[model samples]
Target: MGGTNCPTCGTQLMDGGKIAGRRDPGAQDVSICRGCAEILVLTRSAQGLTLRPTSATEYLELPEDAQSLLRVAHLLVRRQQRLVRAPRQLH
Candidate 1:
């Protein structure tokens, strides 16, 4: 399940990546890598779900519907603006 790579550190995600804690599970959907703290968005297709890197600029580029979701997410939880350093792999 951990096949996706972190855009920031290139660390492979585990368990299809960890869910970014959200108050509104319906609107606030996000995935993150524990190794690099990189945020991502899942794009679903006929094949399956694919995770894409998410940045502040990218968020602005999102469609209005997506923007609305983010807005709702903001009211629910204050997202971290700073980059979280990648933790060392135990291996």
Candidate 2:
């Protein structure tokens, strides 16, 4: 999956607009682009998943596919967090 070039730096992105070597399978926070170093944060809850920039001051945007991936990743992290916070039964 190829990605579009960054508008600011014109860096070509690969794999759904994700930078190489910056992907994290177990990442619960934002992922930064290797070219422009833009932070991509995904948030999820019972409602659904949402992709957005981490900081308001910074104006960075990720491709649509990357945003979708972030949403899924965020959901996974939320699920894991719920499991971790669940109460254990004492036998």
Candidate 3:
């Protein structure tokens, strides 16, 4: 497996020129881009896995619970990014 770039933000979703994450991702697996919080899916090709934005229809097909989880995850990623950009000052 090789590093895949997020199609939406073009952020490199790998580390040290290799895939880096909790586990190896497979084709059709949904992922949220850290750069833009765009929901995406992995696509496999002769080269390697690539990220593509998840379509609205594809998202709707997911179970309600799964969809909710993805939304929450996206929000959390955005929140973390905001925190990193602007840390709160001590009172």
Per-residue lDDT tens digits for candidate 1, residues 1-91, read 4425555566655443443432223333465544445456655555544566676776667677866665654433323534444432311
lDDT of each: 0.50, 0.42, 0.67
What is the C-alpha lDDT profile of model 2 across 7-78, one tens digit per residue?
333445435533333443233345543444434443444543333435533222545686566455545544
Candidate 1 lDDT for residue 66: 65
Candidate RMSDs in order? 9.1, 15.4, 7.6
- Candidate 2 regions with alpha-carbon error over 4 angstroms: 1-53, 56-60, 83-91
In candidate 1, list every pair of residues with a backbone clash.
Answer: none
Kindly give the stretch of ten consecutive residues in candidate 1 with the minimal lDDT sum: 19-28
> What are the per-residue Cα lDDT tens digits for candidate 3 across 31-91?
6777767777776667777777888888888778878877887777778776344321111
User: What is the lDDT ranking, best to worst?
Assistant: 3, 1, 2
Clashes of 2: 0
Q: Which ranking of candidates, highest TM-score first?
A: 3, 1, 2
Query: In model 1, which regions exceed 4 Å deviation?
Result: 1-3, 14-28, 57-91
Better structure of 1 and 3 per lDDT? 3
Against the true structure, candidate 1 reaches a TM-score of 0.40
The TM-scores of all predictions, comma-separated, are 0.40, 0.31, 0.70
